[model samples]
Target: MQKISTCLWFENQAEEAAKFYVSVFGDSRILDVSRFGEGGPGQAGQVITVEFEIEGRKFMALNGGAPANFTEAVSFVVDCSDQAEVDRYWSALTDGGAESMCGWLKDRYGVSWQIVPSVLGSLIGGPDPEGAQRAMQAMLGMQKLDIAALQTAYDG
Candidate 1:
């Protein structure tokens, strides 16, 4: 059992969201689900919380009603090893979602995510300041990160 894990708040969609997440991530599954009891905040037997894992990382989802919502302040970052990996996650996550600049997107559930190449850190933090700046500039203009373009800017 993990000592600590992330929890997502939803409006009576914890089960749906957890299932969707499990389907999206190849290595994921639902661990457990707890339902509301009699006289609880929610209707009896209603889904209250769900426990799941994504790529080995455990996450909990709470059906805390419609009050709580997701925002851009907190986002999950998917570090992709290659363009193919980046495309896979980007396409799946943005299917019914909106795309934002700099490899950011808001999923149908309003959760923000960043699908970026693992090399981004290296290119933007390299010793060459000018190259790093170019890479940064290239990333700023991209919705979904382009590894080739970033490399070109880094090498320019």
Candidate 2:
């Protein structure tokens, strides 16, 4: 078991969210699911918690009550190898969701995710700071990250 796993609070969509997430990331799978007990906070026999993993990172989704609060203060950053990977995640996560600027998206379950290219880190920390700045500026105008466009800006 992971010493510390990230827990996500959902409005009774823990199982659904876990299934959706596992479908998107090939290396992910649902480990276990715990249902609510009789007279528990949630409906009896309903999913209360789901343990899942994506790329070996453990996560727990809790089917808490109504969603009172969820903020962008915390987000999952997906390191994509290329534009195809980025697009795949962005499309899957943003389905029936809202798109935010600079590759940020709020999934249907109200979880914020950042689908960023792996090369983006190196570009931002590269020797050419000016180029990186331009790339960042270009990225700010995009909903889904475009690796080719970012690369163009970096090369310019």
Q: How close is each model in CA RMSD to the real structure?
A: 1.3, 1.6
Error of 2 at 125 (Å): 2.9
TM-score of each: 0.94, 0.91
lDDT of each: 0.93, 0.88
Mark the 10 consecutive residues where model 2 has the least summed lDDT. 62-71
Q: Please give the lDDT score at residue 99 for candidate 1.
A: 96
Off by over 4 Å in 2: 39-41
lDDT winner = 1
Clash count in backbone of candidate 2? 0
Model 1, residue pairs in steric clash: none
lDDT at 51, model 2:
95
User: Where does candidate 1 stray beyond 4 Å?
Assistant: none
Model 1: lDDT equals 0.93
Error of 1 at 42 (Å): 2.2
- Who wins the TM-score comparison? 1
